[model samples]
Target: MKYLKPWRSDGGGLLHLTILLSLAGLRLDLDLDLCLLLPPPTLLRDELLLGCDPTSPAYALSPYPAPGGWGRADQLHPKGREADPAAPPEGQLLREVRALGVPFIPRTRVDAWLVHRVAAGDADGAHGLLGAAAASSAGGVGAGVDGGSQAAPGGGGDPRASPSSPLAARQEEKAPAEQTARVPDADGRASEENEVLRERHEAVDHSSQHEENEQRVSAQEEKSLQQKNEDENKTADKPDWEAEKTTESRNERHLNGTDTSFSMEDLFQLLSSSQPENSVEGISLGDIPALPGSSNDGMNSSAHYNVNFSQAISHDVNLHEAMLLCPDNTFRRDPVVRTSQPQEPFLQLNSHTTNAEQSLPVANLTAFLPFVDNQMRNLTSEDFLHDLNINIFDEINLMSLATGDLDAMEVSQLFQEPDSDSGLSLNSSHNSTSITKSNTSHSICEEGATGYSSDPESLPHHNLEGAVGGNYPAPMGHRSDSGFCGDLAFQHVFHNHTYHLEPRALESNSESFSWPEKPEKMSRYLSDTERNLSRDERRAKALRIPFSVDEIVRMPVDSFNSMLSRHYLTDLQVSLIRDIRRRGKNKVAAQNCRRRKMDIILNLEEDVCNLQAKKETLKRERAQCNKAINIMKQKLHHLYHDVFSRLRDDEGRPVNPNQYALQYSHDGSVLIVPKELVTSGHKKENRKRKREGIEDGFH
Candidate 1:
């Protein structure tokens, strides 16, 4: 199936630009779009598939001629049909060929042997096919001859003989004769027919083998083609592959006139070069309009830029200049007084007014009004817009922020006017010195009466202790006076407390006027009752310790019971005491346990030593016992030999009546006799022998 298809890409923008450039000879504005439409060369395509298998055709053949306009054949060419049986080579005549046509001429020749070799996929098949195709296309007559053997035969004419003849006349004369020679002679014709039949049979067999090879080759190629189709279909079905295809198609459509192949750098260079050559034609800094007043043209007034406070731009000629020059008078209008009747009010000053005087407190509400209105509108309509108000005072307490916890007198000096020497002067002429002396006298008098020691330097200690006095029990002899702050004094104190003063107040006050250095003396103005609790008040007072031993002990138990009932003890506490023994004698138990362990260690050591000693004693005793037993056995054997010798008369046998006696000890030691003697002897004799055995064994 030879199908021809043409692929054309429409060049909308790029084509127009390229055509314009070609016609006009302009060197400007060439982007990748022009580059993209240039068709690929044939060498590129040929190189792409030069090694590709003909049997496995992965791509369709190109319909266009190769770049050089060369006629190109693909590896994936369609198979040829079989030739007629009347043809000399039968299946060997692969396909009818016609070129410079004549009767009995072979079609475009492809070596039958070579084609068979290629079909069979012989080792040299590709080389053979290339050689044959090259030879046949080169118009070699040798390639057309059967088996390429015509040039070798004796019947061959000149090697370069032309096909159209001087031979034509000779062939014409012989044609008639050749026809007449076919008239039958029965035996001769039969023999010629037999030889022709035999040659035809050999050619038929060759053709048959070639057909078989072709069929096998075709089957292989067909199988490969089917597999390739299946693989392509599978790839097309895959999700990523389909996505890639769609993306590629979309890109092809989008960048129809533009090339997507250009890199960022290349595109940038192209864009920069494509820009207009002249600065005038291009956008430049100089072309930008200057600021309103900066322009030299008097007609181009700055009026449009003169914005009033209400945010509206003014077009009044002088107003714009005045706004720039006199910003203070732009928004504030002069108050105008209107007279009721035609009568004019008396002039306040001599008549010296001018044209400029008529324009007083120039009122222009246009500059910032729009901005304010916009802010208000934004707050009203948009949820995102918030009108946030922060009261800075609430974040920090002003009084505590200003007047820190310090003695007022010490703080007052920090805000006071220093002497010429820059040191606090003790001169009584100064109101500050007099005030300090009064406070000192007052403090001393109070301390003397209350039997409390007062120190000028201990004021800070007093203040800290006093702040804690109401919570702590009264100490020593001092007691709080209930009438200390009477109604009038309380009112003064209340007013003082209400009118919060800052430490910096004195500084500001000093800047306004001089301040007394001794602020404490001002407190001395109070009555003795009001001044009852001085700095030494706590020291002068008595405190009865509320916490008794019983209370302390009861508190822990109560707290413990409450905690246990409420399950209030934290995990840390539980872990700490979980393993504590409730009734153990702590110190004694630990000491005794340590002692007992030491005792056990000593006992174990002694026991181990005793066991080793016992083992040694047993071994020594065993050796001694063996020696004694051996000696006793030897004595018994000697006694037996002497007795036997006495009984026998120079013979080793017993001749007289044999008697054996065994003596016993006086202490009634029982004896053991040997089994032979015990069974044979009488009862009395056996008893006597047992007693004697005991005595003899002991010896």
Candidate 2:
């Protein structure tokens, strides 16, 4: 036997002892009933199967073959054998075993136990057993017997031979039996060895069964947790579903309850019924039932109900019918006048008639009197008709003047007064009363001439005076010394026809008597501004205002105030002047505002049209660009295929189109690269870009 070196006194010593026994040709099979003798199947299998002896053919092919060549005989003898220089020291090996957290038995103790068993007559055909056990112990818990034996040439162990593999148990049982058969062991010792092996196998089986049970329990727990989460999600969604259902129900109820259709007549009725007294008589909005799901707040609920009711009523009513149902006095209607026979051409002048009336030609006077009398009679009945008749008479008078039947000089002479000094003073109460009575009697003649009964006593004297004064200008050019009837006449005329008279007529009539021919037609020729100025002119004339409406409106505030101060004006006249100025300014402002609004509207419309055109142009351009892009894409696709099909590798063989692709660089260069390489490069670039974008965002 080879003497073991002091360095090989640990696990290496056992390995050295096993080799010595093998060289001595001993078949001592020690049936030691110690757990240490039956090494763990995992360790035994690793040493016997995975380990390569220097004598084995597998060792010669191994990448890490032993330094010196050794045959089967040499392996059994191993002259001048020493521990492998590559093996760890005893202290390092112990530390490694401790790091692995495995139970470690000292080799000296194991060897001493083996010697004790041999001395006790236990070494029966157990040489092979001892060698296998010693080899396993020397290898340590998971150490390889040889440097390159732990893994295949590929540098990894076989997965099928792993310790945890299901077939490992069967392999473990077979390995022990094979080792036992290698030596001629007694049947009793063999049975005891088999029993010990059986006990160890059962222990491994029990541990595996425990791990499977734990896995099953974990799977059940995960299933329960998932089911609980799903139930929670369902419960959370239930309220939302119920709320939606309620909303739908309310909508259905609202639709079913309300009426939407209406007619024109109903609209009319609704409008007529809107009067304060009648509003409550119709169906009250509050009487309508509230809709389902509506809040029960006080004012809000009532307001909502009223709004709904009003909308429903408006839809069911007509405008015309509503108007018809309105009170008769709500709107004015004209009375129907019956046409009577034409009156006789006759003079029925009263004794109170002025000399101006007496001098007129009978035929001409008769033609004028009846019409004037009719107009005066209708004044109280319908002012519109009275004004219409006046306009008509003015037209007739103009035609008469054109025909030379009525002269302007003749008309002016009528207001001259036959006896200037003898004529009654306008200030005389008796003369004024008489003049008013004569005018009333002249107008009343329509009834007398038409053979109708007259009532001079019942006729209102003031109405007759106002009728004469308002309708016609008093005789002008009356000596200024002859009372203030001109002012009175102007006041009345201004009150009635202020907006109608021409400016020339107003100025001329104010100073002297001058009847312009076709004066009524002059109004038609006036521009809109002139018409507006004329209206202010009339108002100024009525109030006896000294300044023109235009100057009042156009003048600066300081100028206007100075003008107001210069004039001796009553509060009424001053108020009237200010009103005229305000009205004139408002009118001009309104006109300018309307004009600006029209310009703005036109500008907006033009902009809208321009924008629409621009939109259409852009759309067309985009379409053309897209079409060009599509054409380019098609050409590029075709070109790519053509180029790829003709591409050749370094060996002059046609490159596979599917395996290679064309890539464009930022510098506008195109290159052919492997498809997989391009795909992986693109993935990396995308990830880098994404990471950079995220970082930029944080910054």
Candidate 3:
């Protein structure tokens, strides 16, 4: 609300309150909008609360003792002292307890944070001072620090113990420049170690909200939280009299001596207290849900990493299903073969049917299946002109032959040529001959891969692999783009797989991964998330491959070959990945070829029906033309007689209608020629040929 007050006027008279998060003494303020993306119940919180041992690190912040004990050996303590109902108040403390005996959070705040730092394993004088404060019988902090009977539990005399509140700030002003060194790494800068383990179990979340906190506090907060700790440590190293004066000052401020009451004995007493009984409702008194950016999730500097494992790839020995990927990536529990072996056939000794050995084992037969299937599919002819789009039902095609999709265009073209010449007075016989020849030629030529490529090398570089692997290959035909994509699905059922892999990681059976200090690095340690990444990607990461998998899958063959030439790959790597390009292209080519063949067959069938219809139409048109020609001949005969009757030639007689006929020459000249003249020439030629044949025989 305070930050929003100034922005209210600027934001269209509206105000927005931001939520704040603190982690490892880092303040982060986040906008309300980001809450949508970040979910709750993260693993980091669970690990920080439940995983760390308090004495191990400087930040194992289990500050307050457990309900019954500081540690229960996780309820496995041997003496069973906490469970003894008659033991003492301490033993009964864990049973039916509603409140803690002490005020854990104080109203008159001191530098109790210093005590927590000491508990966290800081080796400075803070621990001894705190111990002295704890031995005070007054059940208060200042009562003992003011030269009371309390002494350090470790035999070190009490060091200076000052108030943690604003009282310590006064001493901080008088400190020399040398003792006031600022804390290193207080700039919220992430280090190299932070980059490796981006997601960890105990990382202190420095989410976007945290970044906002830095911005908000940049002006008001001069000393960082770490620097404050360092300054308090310096103030604690003061002389005993200074400590006494500090205690007096706190008394003047009216803060009671309550902070001094806790000690090592208190911790042991708390641990030995009775524990609460379990509830069927599964309720725990200790559950405090932390928000996404809270310190409880990832406050540790050294966050522990949990490893991720991959499912084992399985191989099936069944011949029928061998080519298919397994439903489970791991092996199934089934036996090797499905049915019992057939009994061997018996053979007779003489002139009888002999039995061959029992059929070869299934495993041996499995090897040949792929080869046989490939050969059968390869029998399909290439479809080179498959992609061109044409109207399969053109009117011209229907008028032509009964050709299907492929031959429709050729038939239509032939029909068009004949129609253009039909207007000429050419005889009907000449037109029929040309149409028959065109149809015959369209079907016979240009059949297979041989027509497209002379050798197998031209057919998508099939024969070239061995040749290219061994030596430089000859230049080949243009490459066809035969790439195809299939649905890529990978499933990992969580049951029986999650817990199964955890023990190996705990046992450190796999290779160790370095932990980066960044909070995001926590995801790297989560097996569930890691399992979702690409299997091949994980494989490449594991292999430390220099190039990306996408590049290997997407680049052209020539470019891929060039890349291979650039790097020296192992034989296993070369063989394993060699078929990636071939398989992808072949899948696409098969789809294209299948489509083309179907189109050709369909068009041919259509064209065949179309040509039959045209045949009927042509027959009708030929009958009409023949009838018209006969009518014209009859008209000519009547006109000839009429003209002869009206003739007034030099003899005034009608021309001999039967002897003479009208003829037309190529030069467009009209001539009257005797019909007998034409007949006499044909007859004389035939007689001359017969006479010549007889003369040649006589010779």
Alpha carbon deviation, residue 649, candidate 1 (Å): 6.7
Which window of ten consecutive residues has the lowest lDDT sum in model 3?
483-492
Q: Would you give me the overall lDDT of model 1?
A: 0.25
**Better by TM-score, candidate 3 or 2:** 2
Model 3: number of backbone collisions: 44
Question: 165-196, model 2: which lDDT tens digit per residue?
Answer: 22223334454555445432221122222222
Which regions of candidate 1 fall more than 4 Å away from where they truly are? 1-588, 648-678, 682-699
Prediction 3 global C-alpha lDDT: 0.24
Best by lDDT: 2
lDDT per residue (tens digit) for residues 1-699 in model 3: 000110110110010111111111122111111111011222122112211232221111111111221111111111111111111122122221213222121100111222122224432332222221111111111111212112112211122222231212322343234123422132111110111011111112223223343333321121221123242344346654454344234322321222333221222233223222211011110110112322322122101001000000000011112211112211111111111100000000000001112111222222323332232123212110010000100111111111111122222222222111111111123234322323222211111111111111111111111111111111111111110000000000000011112222222211111111222542434255444544333333222233555666678879988977665442212332343344445656888899999999999999999999999999999999999999999998888777656654468667776777666677999566788876786599799999999999999
Candidate 3 error regions (>4 Å): 1-553, 557-574, 589-628, 647-682, 685-699
- Please, what's the RMSD in Å of model 3? 34.9
Best model per TM-score:
2
lDDT of each: 0.25, 0.30, 0.24
Model 1 lDDT tens row, 19-110: 11111111111221222222222112211111223222211112111122111111111111111122223133222211111111110112
607: Cα error in model 3, Å: 8.1
Q: Please state the error at residue 400 of candidate 2 in Å.
A: 22
